[model samples]
Target: MTKGRAALLVVAAIVFLTVGFVIGQMVQAAGAIPGTAGDPLVAQSYVEKIVGETVASLQTKLDEMQAKVDDLQEEVDALSGDTGTNKGSGKTTLPQSSNPPAQGKTVVVSGDSANIRTGPGTTYAKVTTLVKGDTATMVSEENGWYKITLQDGKEGWVANWLVEVK
Candidate 1:
């Protein structure tokens, strides 16, 4: 072959290989999956859909947490002596006559029936009656009587002779 023709053929082969390499790379890029190691490009619509779903899930969780906080606040308000009413149960809670003693002890009524009086003496008016096996928390002692708090938080006096300290 002539030197000029051989040189022309070599240049043509180099150009053809370069074009083929470029086309092969374009085809591989077109076939690659988005967001994968082969392709890092992600579509905007796909990102928006994922972000919207995550935001919705977080909003649902936040609503549930707010409801729980509201319920707990109501309970705390009721316990802190607000309105003298239990909001959850719709019941009137009586105020404690006095704070429980640091060394309060449980006592049971040993008599057939014992009077719960407003005062320690027999002259005091009867508020209620406690029968045998009825229990109360003895707050303090007064003149042969025991000042006690009932289960319902009511305070009254009972004769010590009619109760057995537990």
Candidate 2:
């Protein structure tokens, strides 16, 4: 499950467990005492102490669990390469270094209105633009983005899918 969904489930479980604890306390308080002349105050005190300790323990466990969740989220973000628009499945997938065929070549922008980003990812700002049939010199590549020099001497990166090696 996603981290968000798992976090939500943990919250829901805490709420449910809290309600159940409160209800169980109430039921226990409502019952008669074996001795002490059926004093309501004593029974209330006992139930409150038990419930308080239990809730405190539960809260501690939840805090520990939350910390674990945060650590897992960080690991996931690192594995995804932190591209906002793209996340390759990290499981059993081959790592790609660069485009073998496009490097050291002039490539034609294959897509209409391809965005030239400031960096090697679409998460970067669009420094300029390219259109279908526009030719750019491929400078380098990483993670499916190609560094290119545009016709007017502007340099930026484009999605590898947007260009064809020539």
Candidate 3:
């Protein structure tokens, strides 16, 4: 064939192949299901289902943690002599019985020096020290420890064995 005709035939053949490939791709895309090997896109329903499952799992974990916190709060209430009712105040309050000492009741340090802690235990952080003859107002007593308010209004716990209540 002549050069012109051969060139035209080659161009026509290329256009036909291109058209066929485009049509085949369109057909496959229309028939393929999302989230399948043939389709890269994921269905919205499938994504939502996975998210729902994850949320449910997280909620279960949160519920378990909340239960633990509630149990811990109950134990703290018992130890601190709280009535376990805040009257919707969301703040824990100590009962009157927890501070049975008469108002203005004081204690004198019997030892040379006594370490006053933040809590009613030696394992707690020490807040201050009281020397012999230093007196503190008694607030409460727990676990053989006396919770006292110092002259400076700071409250701390001291071993009951080291103090004489007056």
Candidate 4:
């Protein structure tokens, strides 16, 4: 054959092969083969179903958590309401004194010089001194002496004659 004709035939063959390759690629992308199960529609539906279920479950969990938070808020409100007027909790008033002397009851000093002793008697170590009108809590009273707790939480005894029950 002549050189020009042979060149033309080679060019035609190359074009045909390129066209066939392009067609093959298009067919593979279409996923039309039977039993291959790679259809775009089917894959999209599966992904959508899984995502929908996940979102629904998350919503349900959020609702349950909100319910628990609401319940806790109700309990807190109830507790706050009960604390305002409940006199039985010991936080409302001081204990009432029943006898002449009792611990934790407030009393006033009646003397100018009162010695606070370590124990409930005169022989114990003198802890401190209390001036007149110094109010203290009478812890106990024995033999005309009063065991008392000072304002600073110190425990001691004072002459009963120097303290008057208030």
Residue clash pairs of candidate 4? 103-139
Pairwise lDDT winner, candidates 2 and 3: 3
Using Cα atoms with residue i matched to residue i, what is each candidate's TM-score against the true structure? Answer: 0.39, 0.42, 0.39, 0.38
lDDT of 2: 0.70
Residues 1-166, model 4: lDDT tens digits: 6999999999999999999999999988776543334654456556655665665466446546655665565666577786435422321222333556656788787755566777654445668766668898878776567778899998888767667888
Candidate 1 structure quality by residue, lDDT tens digits, 1-166: 6999999999999999999999999998788797544555777666655665665466446546655765676778877877735444432233333543333899898855677889875546678877668999989876567899999999999877778888
lDDT, candidate 4, residue 132?
A: 62
The predicted structure with the larger TM-score, 2 or 4, is 2
Total clashing residue pairs per candidate? 0, 0, 0, 1
lDDT of the structure predicted as candidate 3 = 0.72
Worst 10-residue lDDT window, candidate 4: 87-96
Which candidate leads in TM-score? 2
Angstrom error at residue 84, model 1: 40
lDDT of 3 by residue, 5-30 (tens): 99999999999999999999999879
Which TM-score value belongs to model 2?
0.42
CA RMSD, predictions in order: 23.5, 26.3, 20.6, 29.2
